[model samples]
Target: MTATATIDEVVCLRPATSTDFDLAGVINSLLKPVYELPGAELVHHLSGIGDVGRMIQDALDEAPDDLYATGVPSSGTDHAVWPVGGTTVEAGAGARLAVGITLPVDGSQDIFLWDQDASSDDLLGSVTISEAEQGQGSLSKLAHSDEEHSYYYVNYHVD
Candidate 1:
């Protein structure tokens, strides 16, 4: 009989820091004109520009690490069982995915985490789950890059 592995959620304990700041600064500058428009001040005040700006600046201070995951049911296979392309999750947030993927009882799956960016994608880390690990469980992995480190928690179950 075949068993199915279900992905419950992926939690980001910490996000990676960005080394590229010039590009982000340039992008923010391009949006300055929008803030200079007439009535923009009123809108800004109504929307709490101080708070919004702080949040935007905070995000720009780090890598726009929009996270996503991919699960390969088996090694040497070009097929992916979950997230064909990817399902993006917010930085330092958890994505609850009740995606179930079926595999042979003796089969195993490798799950990878990635940070999606405009320039290029960064691989965060990966974890392998075997059918023998059936039942609810969580796995943790740390992804390191130059001076940045990212921590992730993956929760899943096989039955």
Candidate 2:
């Protein structure tokens, strides 16, 4: 008797981890989402020299093709100081930066990654400034223009 061809079933195998893997991510924000670190800051700055018109033109000329990232990210303190340190950019005519920071759900502590250089920036209004402007006068305009003004009454918690 001719042996009938036996129909067979086969199974493809996969690595244990691949099949039974554990992965986590915020798929859908249930209630205002959760961030390991929450808070967004909108920082605006004017870097360069010349009159308001010139400064604006210069800023625009030197503006990054992408306005969103014109300057590199430095410590809030350092970013503040850069304007005054150089002979190229006028001390007062340096960068005028502005950014908005959204406070974290877990208090200010869970906001920014408060690194070594970045202490809790005592905010002036909702805006956090560079270190140079700290301890100045009423606002950035007063601080950068006046020599007597120093220190800010605000801080950005980045821890």
| Index of the highest-TM-score prediction | 1
Tell me how candidate 1 scores on lDDT: 0.51
Clashes of 1: 0
**CA displacement after TM-score superposition, residue 137 of candidate 2 (Å):** 13
Q: Which ten residues in a row have the lowest lDDT in candidate 1?
A: 72-81
**In candidate 2, where is summed lDDT lowest over 10 consecutive residues?**
9-18
lDDT of 2: 0.20
Per-residue alpha-carbon lDDT of candidate 2 for residues 41-94, written as tens digits (9 for 90 to 100): 111211112234234224223211101111223334343322233211211212
**Cα lDDT of all candidates, in order?**
0.51, 0.20
lDDT of 1 by residue, 1-159 (tens): 456766655544335656465644564466445433433223325245445433544665654456666564232112334444545655542222344444444577677667766766676667777777766454332332323444455556677
